[model samples]
Target chain A: MNDQNGLTIAVVGATGAVGQQIIETLMKRDFPYKKLVLLSSARSAGKKVNVGGNELIIQEARPESFDGIDIALFSAGGSVSMELAPEAAKRGAIVIDNTSAFRMDPDVPLVVPEVNEEDVRSHKGIIANPNCSTIQMVVALEPVRKKYGLKKIIVSTYQAVSGAGNAAIEELELETRALIDGKPYEPKVLPVKTGEKHYQIAFNAIPQIDKFEDNGYTFEELKMMNETKKIMHDSNLHVAATCVRLPIETGHSESIYFEIESDDVTADSIKELLKEAPGVVLQDDPANQVYPMPADCVGKKDVFVGRIRKDLDNNKGFHMWVVSDNLQKGAAWNTVQIAESLVNLGVVKKK
Target chain B: MNDQNGLTIAVVGATGAVGQQIIETLMKRDFPYKKLVLLSSARSAGKKVNVGGNELIIQEARPESFDGIDIALFSAGGSVSMELAPEAAKRGAIVIDNTSAFRMDPDVPLVVPEVNEEDVRSHKGIIANPNCSTIQMVVALEPVRKKYGLKKIIVSTYQAVSGAGNAAIEELELETRALIDGKPYEPKVLPVKTGEKHYQIAFNAIPQIDKFEDNGYTFEELKMMNETKKIMHDSNLHVAATCVRLPIETGHSESIYFEIESDDVTADSIKELLKEAPGVVLQDDPANQVYPMPADCVGKKDVFVGRIRKDLDNNKGFHMWVVSDNLQKGAAWNTVQIAESLVNLGVVKKK
Candidate 1:
């Protein structure tokens, strides 16, 4: 598949959860590459990953590793992205950073393709991926915005532990078994692991997803509020988020209550818009008991929208349930989609 | 402890989940009664309950059983309450109905003592206990309402399976183990088990808590909407709910977004109001990571409120997280409190 547009692609932090999914999504989609480069922290540098039936050795990620790379996918921790993303961009490689380090930066274009693909063209070398929760939400809401014109959004997320990293998933499993065995196990990973106290995430709901900001919104909540505005290019749109971590392992579900600027919008109108919306699957059939659930959304790239209804007594208000695989559309698929968009738009040329 | 108002107090549905909690709550509060009557359906009727060094045999709840009973606490299913509540009321016994039988019936008062205790005095032989989800919400919001006068509410609930029934809990446990062992398990008791096709609750979230109503709100959601109005006595106030079933077994957590009529209401003022409000535990220390979780609230009776914050750019809007043991404040404890209120207010007197 190598041609004039063929280029080397590097995946930073290539062995973690989202990294693994990004590799799978790229291979399954048959992403074109002249050479595949895998980079990770020194601890996982020597690990090998099989991509499209070919084993690629992961090298330690350093600023010098971006030499001759056309596109770099960074899923490493925020600190790594903060230090290496600029370096990779300075090396003539366009960096699609998946960390929060550059997402809120005014110069960094946040791309969701379905919602803001054109934003990628304006990327100043470093493109930022929206938060997983925000990506799924913007995907589900973009069609509505196009049709009905969104004014305000209040979302409460039933998020999965996988969004907290692989350690949180392990903690959920361990705590489930510990609770089943009637053994006293202290929680060490959920509701912000580095915070003062931890709560078991196995069969409980933790209201906190990220560290609490002084305004009482968690950082995760703030990400949804800020990223939605940036990606939608509407700073005047009112957005509020309550990010909660539940026991689910992969898919993240959100209960979104929104008001449209147009009063002519109905629940069926929103459903119809979502039915044809790209990267959105409308599962709202109340008579058939069809609605999106996290378990049903595992491994899926499409954001599922269901339970669509007009708010009682408010002609302008509507509520919808949205679910998407946090690791897929939320992270990996979105990242790969951005790369694909870059190629289709002819933004990046062959090395 | 016997006095001129000494009377027999009967607890219908005394053997089930919330029924047992009601018995325990009564014992802890030292609820006064000259005689205690325990009644249940024929299946649970011959069983016995030991409460505070007293063992009472469960009797079949027939119409004649209300004889000589001055007060009746009904935590039985809706059918049983619909059948037996009127019989108890006709027999001169004040009935505290915990089911959805008469909550919306304009004639019956839906009372949450903290929110609408004044309405308790106007009960015409029957005082309807608000839905479990509604009780916690009204408790959390009543203080805010008393301080700032409420306007609108939008809530999404993460409810426990125990609210469905005892069998749903068993189904969740068995399905969880089956899923872990890579075994196929048919769900028989979740997302409306009586309807066609049961869904798994293990490591999953079900958006439908009850069957769909004509308004597109699930039965559980409607209960919150209707009961909130009745308890808060605000038929003109806007309310919307999205009820969901998570894997958790006991507590019901609500992500509530509300607007107050007054711009003077701050998140800090709401917190101070809740801290001083009766039966409310303010767990709002985000710095210490002290938000409430269902696991910590499994056996407790207090409604936990935390993550309170004012909405940015909206002076009248605020958000809060409300949680409590669904079986407690949501059902049993609220039922017992109604019974206590009947005696304390001298609404029910001995013959």
Candidate 2:
């Protein structure tokens, strides 16, 4: 309410999980915005949300919604973003999309500010955010990649249900209660809500996260593999991912095994490197039983890493566990950080 | 009993989790036995467990209690087996010990019947069962190794609470109920019941399983690493493990990435081989949404394999998911299968 002389910002998908977080994050970071426009689909247009002592009614998102907006944050479904992002950019608004719509587009720069902040300079009105699983991993590994030169990576994720959406979280909670009470519970929202088959995620682990590709990799797994290379600017890097959904609610945890190009690299050196890396917290004290866990990392912005150890056979290979909030650093905080980077780089000027 | 000419089998620690499964498996498999003896520690000595509709009293396990027994199965704690396993063996009873005390011993055989049944002939009275996680993985990989020659393996495990014991399962049930009810719950049994630290496993994933070794790998992780090497008889194979505990109650799932010695192998060939491999079921079908899940694998004795795919960058590398009932295949069924192998190999006489 006090930034009356700043740039105008609009938040699309204002009622969704990441959208709500984006609003909170904008307020938390004291984002320089003269007017914050809240927009959503027609189904949710009339909802009201309180923002810093001002009540804002959600409006149906349209091409005209970006009329005078300087920076529009789009996090609705991928189709909505695919349709609305270019229109927003056409109207002179820099759209930071939180969907997978324009991520792999040659014109769009997929940015993780800590890893590739300068890539924002090349954004064609729409800068893409990487996948939640990819964001935490690349943040933890960028320092090592910059120092030792990474050659390969194999990651298996223990992802929370919140990564699926709000309905999936509700399904986990409801199904867990039904199972605990010895009542029949039918799953209708996991492994992909619109997918044909549904699996119980309560007290169980589902190996599939999204629709499968022809090559047998899930879309989420492919995102991790592809997004890492794009953000790091290395097309030749070796990466593979197995993303599995767990009973967790918010954080995404990964077991990563990687090989560096140099043979002299040790786990200790990597630990020391991550200890000083930005947006990364090293939590690898096994003696005192200190390590990052999903429950402990909920709502945190920093990527927490622990259990760093060198492979017994390969001196160049190292293993670590990384955990972070999927909704925060993986989605909201990272998006807000990109906006801050835009403001710092003078991509968006204060009016 | 009907089998008047069959062997006399004694079950030590006959009241614990694996012991209960051992009894049920024997009944389910119709194991040939004349006199069935049940023995436990002094604390559980007067308890009664019905076996095949016959009430059997649990006697105190001692050196003399194993007299005239043809085969003895031990699933008690390590110290209990360290003290009583040798006693059972000295009384002319071939011992099948489930504790880790004698697994690495040069004179004892660590047997998974499907992987290395011939290793039973060298057993000097005690045949050891491998850890739950190790048993399922080695079973799934032995066929792969024999056909294509595995050179490297990196695994991340999604384990169940029952792998710890029956008490840990109870703790999961109680803690999950508390969390669902929005009440406070304390973790007293997970990661390691007696270990210094406890973490919430309800709606959370705990990376630490068992105590952390000096090298930063948990003891459970070390078990997966060491046991895989020993079972496969490849001391130089490169293996790394990140063992994690989830809230699942029965099945343990593993995401395994492996490099074969040959570069011409395809994902289809691996699936074809596992489809016919003993004690392994291939459940990979992405088109029909068929894959191995923890809930579906409960009460199953066979190891379920799915999601087989080739790596995008490495031609010789492959990834797959393996799941099995931890209590059955990982412990009781594997031990009973070892006994059946002994009977088939003519090592144990039924006269």
Candidate 3:
């Protein structure tokens, strides 16, 4: 670690699923952190977790927890972020939130470094990472939007159980194993954990992701539609999302149909731009049966795009399949990338 | 079975997955039939399957097998249909082919009875069944189309492995069980059974269903796109599809975005129309967390429609989730329905 460049970092929800992935991604990307502070709820306060190499003690996150923290990443649920994010920001740390609490707030800058890097510099002490599904989609379509101008985007998501948190993942596994063994099992944590109803997600697809909104869309779907527009800096962009959860443990796949403003754009030209785009991996060789899948992109840090096709009827429209590890590039990597951008752009305050 | 108003029926691919379901559907629906003749490939000949509590011996399919048959329902592979469908039809039997062979042929009318039962009478000896993914979508959307006049349709399917036949179903189960037990297994029948590559479909989603067509869309995607227009009798309708195979064994779910010509359609009006549409069951109630899911619609005879929503930007556009049993309605029941339409419409030959 370089003491001159490294800054103090605090990770809220250090014991949770996306939280652990954030810690691992920081270590993997060799993120500059002279000192790492791990924080959790009171129930897991004294728990020990291994960092890059050394064991670190988790402390309960509080108003005073961000006393000297330069960068704090929050993945602890929306309520915790609502309660503690302002406290951390007021104490001096620039918070990078992974929940939806501050995302739609006009004061907060929702950032996906590859799609909206400059937005990171405008953050007023807190930068919001876009939703998991939105992050991968924006990463895949930003290049195209920059080249031809995106007019409309309609997406249908095949999301993993892991996006609902670790408990949902365990439920998928236990339910799958039980169903295979011909044993009956009860589902307690799927579709919506807080909602009264739960559905079996193993070997099935549930159309509802989060709670349903009055408009008949799920919160997850709204997050995707809203966050994509914000991150892409296009308020007029037509975006619609149908978010569904599958039994997959990691990686989220989306089938996106987008209409570009230009009439001259072809599928190959879009593929060419994506080939060199930042944070995107082109896995689209349809002749060879090579396309992105959840299992293949589980540990990857880049969004994978494939199945690029020109719409048979609509000349200006095209379709693509985007996939990425929901926990990695979708949350952890995107959050860490934002932190790196802040450090590079001198957005983090000096000690 | 009584001879009065009964027709001798022959089922091609009698030993395969859809063929067995077709036979069962006939009995379940109480179809009029004086005799049942089972025909299969030479490799599957001599196999016996119980039909309506009677053991029917599967016989080798040949030109002579069509003798005295009034109607033949074909569910064998496409090659089998191409070879024997005409042979059966030439002997005065109306061939309801359930393969992709004659679906696009001008001489063969592609039919989804609920959508276009009148198309059944125009069949030149052979009538084609729409693809599983297309069948369910058209069945769900036909009412909307009829009321408002469809303009465009974009569908992304989370299809079941059983659509690929019994081998793919076995592969999903075997691979899932092996993976759950932490054992190794080979995937021989997924993505495409005859393709050069094989991808794991357990705990994953494969974006390619059938083999890739020359134009980047897979064969299955083409089926959904092409067959929708034909069955709906709208050549100018804009249709696009992205087909992906999931580990689900029986039911197929589609996230469909469609546009109608009418400017005055609301989501509620659409729901009301579907509530009264034949062969459709409306399962949309976001408040109570009720929606159409593959697991819930496994053996259902009707297409399940849910999550009806109006597009935020496009007034003419609406989105929905459609689910149906791929083996039941998607294939066998739809095939049997076409047969019943023939009898009801007096399209079948009378003895």
Candidate 4:
């Protein structure tokens, strides 16, 4: 579909879980697009997908797939993004890559629109989306950091299996059913599919998300720690994370402990700031037993913040519960938001 | 079966989940008992239970039920323990109450035998068992605190449904099956049974474990914080906890970050210390992908510790993963151990 007077949009890895969500969001939001192209790997290239009544076929994503594309969303693994993102950028498309390929690159701007929409304008063709867990936390924390300067962050994540991709979700279902029926099944994925050993995640929690680095932190944890500094543009801010995969299928939940630069900040003030913060929904009322829960935030695009409280001993410390759909706010929605920001900021022009 | 030379023992709430585990542990450990009596609420009073080929009828627990009983293990709800525990203690029985009714009472000795067995000597007849989550964490941290002189502690728990008792376990199962079958089911028992709203825990994480206090911390979190200080006998130790319940059936997992009083303590040294720590299993081999996981720790007695690493920027801070079966080590085994310790220390005598 080509209007020839509106923005031409392309979605790479369109057959994957996050990719499919990106397409759905674009249609749901009625995004202004002249042409919509869906691209995937060779294995899934020929599949037909129906998006809001339009039948589209997924093409093989290659370097030349970005022709005349004004905005390209890439989620086709790190290697695919590494090969095609820069190519798409060279062909006049603003590449919003969802993989970790260029996120930590000094030249690439890692943008969480709610936290760093301004960084999107400084992008050198390719804008990187933060990790699913990192995106939600930064969105919740940015409002606070802006009001009362952040000094330190300690986060523990209860992430969903969908963050690992489609196969892991299937694995969880199969393993859970097998366990329930007293049948035998093997776990071939989880904690990292290609990693050394496979552990059961049906009714359990695995403390390792991505592979462990030499420094003993998993790559997922390092992403949150390093990306927070990059997106917030704060090198002096102390951040530590322990990322773990739970049996959940969609949303990621985090228990965050943070210290502000000033001691005068109370939990109410933080809640007040977040109540009006863009892309955040405060669900924190303990009296009615209200708090952000992963299952409740499954398809929501906004980060849900709750369980806000001041630390009992530390006057400057606070705790919060953050929950968001790993596929939406964590990946697809943020990617689309960056593109939308590009147009709103007049950085991308319809050709 | 009366041994005639051993102590007369009674198990309260013996028909419930944790109660059954207590009977199993007692039978497995070959506890020295002249006579074994099982007691429950009036509704289940006439039920017969088989423990190690011995059939015993459950009697309604009452003030006079503790007559001639030297040791009474109480795990009925907090209200029941509040009503019956002291009465049993006054009747010459050393009450090892597993409910939270008297845990924080100044007169009741809250004891985790591995961490503070000596506190058992000053029990004032009623020895309170700490919360399941608190019991596992303190067991893991006690050795580290002893060797390194801990200064601060922050923990986030991935707790099991079993901690909420049998109905909650059934709720997790029914809810999970309903969700899997594309059916609708109401959450009646999670986060808190009597609280305002119930959230699904089948494929999600609930941040609120128990009722919220005025300061916004859940009762479960407060129990962990206050109980840690009391068990460690350090009023000055800084401790904070965020307790969340997972869909797990048995084991509870915790991510702990602590700062030692000494800066010279290394991750390797901490691992070395925990390797020989009593009732603590060191499973921190990241190279071979060995760490504590909830599913693997089910039915286990020891607190499994792993993923020990030093914080990147903070020299005094360290992180570790701790897991244990909430029913076994966290409640039943710990309660039985306290009774055994009393005998070993000559505090309990066979009349």
User: Which candidate should be chosen as best, given lDDT against the real structure?
Assistant: 2
lDDT of 1 at A330: 97
lDDT per residue (tens digit) for residues A1-351 in model 4: 235578989999998889989998898775678889999999999999997788999999988889989899999999999999999999989999999999999989999988888887788899999999999999999989998999999999999999999999999998888887788889999878899899999999999988888878899999999999999999989999999999999999999999998877889999999999999999999898888888888788999999999988899999899999999999999998998889888898766
Q: Write the per-residue lDDT of candidate 2 for residues B90-203, one digit (tens) a residue.
A: 889999999999988989888899988999999888999999999999999999999899899999999999988889999999999999899999999888888888889998
| Predicted candidate 1 versus true structure: per-residue lDDT over B216-282, tens digit per residue | 7898898888788878878998999999999998899999999998876678888888899999999
- The better candidate by lDDT, 1 or 4, is 4
- Per-prediction TM-score: 0.98, 0.99, 0.98, 0.98
- TM-score of candidate 4 versus the correct structure, residues matched by position: 0.98
> Which residue pairs come into collision in candidate 4?
none
lDDT score, residue A263, model 1?
74
- Provide per-model DockQ scores: 0.80, 0.90, 0.88, 0.85
Error of 2 at A37 (Å): 0.9
lDDT by residue (B238-299, candidate 4, tens digit) is 98999999989989999999999887778999999999999999998887889999888888
Instruction: Pick the winner on lDDT between candidates 2 and 3.
Output: 2
Give stretches of model 3 more than 4 Å off: A2-5, A349-351, B1-5
Give the runs in model 1 whose Cα sits over 4 Å from its true position: A1-5, B1-5
Put down candidate 3 lDDT per residue, B60-87, tens digits, no spaces. Answer: 9999999889989999999999899998
Clashing pairs in 3: none
The better-scoring model by DockQ among 2 and 3 is 2
Candidate 4 Cα misplacement greater than 4 A, ranges: A1-3, B1-3
Candidates' C-alpha lDDT: 0.89, 0.93, 0.91, 0.91
Residue A262 in candidate 1 has what lDDT?
91
lDDT of 3 by residue, A1-351 (tens): 435557999999998999999998888876677789999999999999988678999999999999989999999999999999999999989999999999999999999888888888777888898899999999999989998999999999999999999999999999999998899999999989999899999999999998989999989999999888888888999999999999899999999999999996788998999999999999999998889999999888999999998999888999999999999999999999999999788787444
